[model samples]
Target: MEEQLFEATRAGSKRNDAGPSRGGGEMQSTTGATSLKLLLDTNAFIALEPTSTAVERGLEFGAELARLAAEGGHRLYLHEATRRDFARDHDLARRSAHLALAAKYPALSGIPKSALADLLTRLDLPAPPLSESNDAVDLEMLAAVGAAAVDYLVTDDARLRGRARRTGLAENVLPLAEAVQLLRDLSPRPLKPPPAVEHVLSYQLDPHDPIFDSLRDDYPGFDAWFAGVRRAHRPAWIIRHDDGRYAGVMLVKEETDTPYGLPGRLLKVSTLKVTDEAHGRRYGELLLKTLFNHAEHHSHDAIYVTVFERHATLVDLLTAFGFRDHGRSPVGELVLAKGRRPSVQDAALDPLKFHTTFGPPAIDTRAPFFVVPVEPRWHDVLFPDYPGQLSLLTGEHPYGNALRKAYLCNAPTRRVAPGSTLLFYRSRERSAVTVAGVVEDVHVSHLPEEVARYVGRRTVYTLEDITRLCRSARPVLTLLFRQDRLLEPAWSRGELKTAGVLNGHPQSITEVCNEEGRHWLQERLNEQR
Candidate 1:
């Protein structure tokens, strides 16, 4: 059956030398790095063709993929199943044309029946007799990914992606947009980091930009209100993409006369908008992170934003960070407020709850503390504000920009309770504890997809990195934590060892289980205050 299938699909197909070279299925680039093997599903394969009709419908993701493949020296391939899929097309001429077009790309080696069956079982798919050609092809492509036959299976099928996610292959499956983004991330580029949020005068903004279109539509006086803000020289934070387009903006003001009967000096978020193009990049969280950092740095008592109910995404993000709904504004917009002041009752709240409630720089003393050793490379990315390490350009990453971040490791120590205190001990040259954080959640998984989903945008590691980490045999420990503060006058390795906070240097996530060590660490923290 397999031999017949192969012969039937290859009858009129001819190989092209410029395409993937067929051997043991290993392709090498001129750069000496092993080329990343990408298996394209039927839809992606057709859509990615230079002359495909879909290109006219704004399928530029194909162009980006092609550029990445050319520049990055990656190899793209079509699976035998995809060829079979094309052969099944009812239009005889179209079928021949597609097979001819597909022939230009290298065909991935077919999976053996036993291996394919096992993969299907592992992926929780039913055995054979798939009613549709697309369904059969989807299973085959996913099976190829399951066998690690390809680095990634690129597809636009939402149902296929949903299945991959269910089967723990989410990390290996890429929708066109994410695939393009990932490829861009992997491609060689300049060393300049992504742009950080900039504090600018409100007058510097162009109100006519499409970013304000929604705001203008929602509020009749948005344009005039913005003009007044510009006239008053109100401060705003803006994030611009590398291409010099506005990605997000947040307009802010200081109000002494609290509306809705709120207390203390208030920092009102007048307008917070992230452009449609930057939707899934965590620019919203990035903007909020900047806002919270600004409010806390300037010692604002409370922070609030009045948002309409229509913006569900922003509302969910705000409430997740401990912003409470305090009734509605005079114009019917929902008022969400978060108190910045740490209170005595804060110590009683769980570690995660406490950080979210008070917005970091506050930890529950009642929680147990652990010293997690980190290398300088990761330490710099996770704690970008570390005094001496601030100069290191770790590049612009979502994890680095947000207060809520995840740490992935193969540490054997199980059971890091949520709300536990973590002292990030930066190892190597500057061997000392430099950062503190409170745990929000803890999970252990050997599956890369599960780890990726759990960490979401909170992780600094790429999916490729996560896959490699999972391949180490040991289960990956994901620590979801909120960064609390940079430890001032960082406790040195020598000091920690002397104080019994460490018996030498911590090689893994070590707990300060001893009373002496805990007490000594507490005294040091108290001294810093």
Candidate 2:
């Protein structure tokens, strides 16, 4: 069991993203790292605690954590904010942890609550603002890493993942499971091509550090920014650098803040430039990927960039890393957004449109109309974990009335032909970037609400928009007609995951199996097929 854990801790984070994540999309990683500074979020703590089932499985989650920290390959850290967040959100578990810790170390337990809180605070755990935003715990976790000068933080929390990326702290972010995997990569990846600067770097150096003078002119506002960062008293990483060339550098929020409320760990890459002299190697992607692993470890919400439309290709490249596309314009550039609401809804009840299917059976090929996949421009999106989500969605979400109207009736049956629009919301990990799938074949009676939007309308979806849209507006989701395009430069995980509904169904319906994940629907279709 320990062996399995040790190996997991040593594996690369790139491999952990093999499964489907957000917006019915897949994270196909091409880069990763082995040993990284590591931290854990509340969810990670829960999963690793001996009392948790994750430990009972002989996985030995906690012991492995200790081992990683002790071995130096994994720098396991915990922030006060992280612990506090855990205590607040998962009160019972945290209380249990406190009690257990007290029992394990009687002397520590005897410490007063206030003293303990102070001590824990002194221990340097991250605890951000829980009032204006719920990211206090998340930010605290990142701060712990920045304070401890650790390189990674691991957790499954969506918001944390997004936050890590935004603060230029991507290198210190990671997921619990993903961190375990990274522990295995100690051998390191062979040096790749020199990174072509993917984005520009814009930030002033900290004047407190001697090198600040050399870089101050280029970075601009070095003294003020660093002072402000220090004044915040939050855990901001001031890695005084290995070369002694830099005394201390603050790497947090120098770029973007918790995305104007789009949720999850969202970051705007304000500084992504590599030194011009290092231009020969394409290490930017590889390095960023490593940084991203660190960011994921730390639990930020999402990483974003306000790039002009002119850099479409560069944007497309980042899209693959789960760095979702946020539709906002870069300043100094003329940003244009064209929107005309074709369907209007009453302002009060605000009826969001959707569809429903009677039941299912029969149907063979998804070639004509089965599960037409989707293509969200931004691949990486995270969301908060909600209840009743473990069960594969059959129809409308039963937890809320707003969502319930879209649920599918799992029983009664029939042979659905290709082109059946089943609009069911597919949940993304960190962000609820709802993915609506269009049924191309009739296998099981898939949910129809999401289909109404995917196959029903001829509109273009910022695929991740529904997640943001659902929070404020529930549009009148309705579907009409559009010629089926089984194959057209298929790009999207929804097209593949939507098919999972039919293929993953337990009921014996049609011999038509559409289990081809993202590729299931339009995977093999011709451009005109």
Candidate 3:
């Protein structure tokens, strides 16, 4: 039976947007309960606007958010304050742009006077006096939430979020990313399997490949750049879809001389583009991830990109992955750079401080580590670069060795939690338990979309595989872990048996509760130290 759902709302935010349901719409819960109603804060709507400067470099950030909401059966609402904000803006051009985007969501109007009065009293704020003509809209926005006009408010403003939390509406307030993840969990889509990597061939691009034509707008001198890349023997990895079409492309070049003042081996991303059809599906993210791995393997001291200022979405993405603005390039383009080590202090403290940002997960010395077996097929992503073997792992992640994530649906992993040590065992030909790390966070949700949005930004899984995993009622558990330490002289299955750490072949995530098993694994790991 479906459980009853409830919503309480109250708000006076830095940026405000609210709306009522124009139609009963598709906002119905799969379990036949009331669906979540989301209101966009004014800044969110502003972000959707394409600036006059954003020409060929413009991004459709709004479309992706809308898609998630619609697919997840959530109704988008706009507070009447959004309209007032639009009208109050003195910049005619910017106001028009804001209005254009605002038109997409239905605007909510009319509020009960008693509800507004009650909300003001509860919030302990005075009603805007007649003298304060400019303040009524903001008060109205708060009243809308207080009256439960909408279940949640989405915003990017930090101050607004703080205010919401202070007023005991923390759960009702959400960041844009969190809002999308939540909605997806509430309304996950059906599954569709992705094509295997075996089907997609990888090859180096010749300087004269016609494929460069499509990228001319982004890279004006593509041919010249390609010649240099080819001469350096640095291939621009391209992934072809099953239909033998270009899915995405990425180009990287090692630069010794850069205006960004990146010393040593600095890698510059020259091109990263995905076909139009692959936009929301994460084709671009896949290629960019490959470029990161390539840079890491090549011993690049830093990675940087020269992007047009108009490409806000791309810039935001790079920033999210720890790229900092190194000011502007000689060509007047934005110079974003990311280094192996984040700060001078970190380098001074520990030479290999790549993943030390959060430090290692706290250790629970009293508990035994969980020994989980991973198949060879999934090893490339789950555990990259099996020593003495070629590393098929290609991707740039904010968390290097310090933090890694693994997706699980098994019974044992669901029981895993923060501070739990995990000893990973590689199955098949490798047939050894080699790496160990500590768990930092565990996310278990039945919605694939929720899992994807939360971790998909860094996952190795394709969209199809992620969607498929989320399709079933079985919960998808994503384990975020940190501080990976490789075990020297891997413990082979035979070795494990002789040591009494195993009785037979292990198939799932098994906890090492046996005292002997814990001692044996710890002894081996301690030797490396």
| Candidate 1 Cα errors over 4 Å, as ranges | 1-192, 342-347, 391-398, 456-460, 523-529
TM-score of each: 0.66, 0.26, 0.52
Query: What are the runs in model 3 whose C-alpha is more than 4 Å off?
Result: 1-28, 31-72, 83-223, 227-233, 241-245, 256-261, 275-277, 325-327, 341-353, 356-422, 425-478, 481-529
Candidate 1 positional error at 76, Å = 16
Worst 10 residues of 1 by lDDT: 1-10
Ranking of candidates on lDDT, top first: 1, 3, 2
lDDT of 2 at 297: 46
Task: Score candidate 1 by lDDT.
Answer: 0.70
Best by lDDT: 1
lDDT against the true structure, per candidate, is: 0.70, 0.33, 0.55
**Weakest 10 consecutive residues of candidate 3 by summed lDDT:** 2-11
lDDT of 3 by residue, 236-323 (tens): 6765665656666676666758555677677888776555444334344445456555665576767788888665546645663557
Question: Regarding lDDT, does 1 or 2 come out ahead?
Answer: 1
Per-residue lDDT tens digits for candidate 1, residues 252-318, read 9999697888899899999888875564456777788778778867889898899987675577669
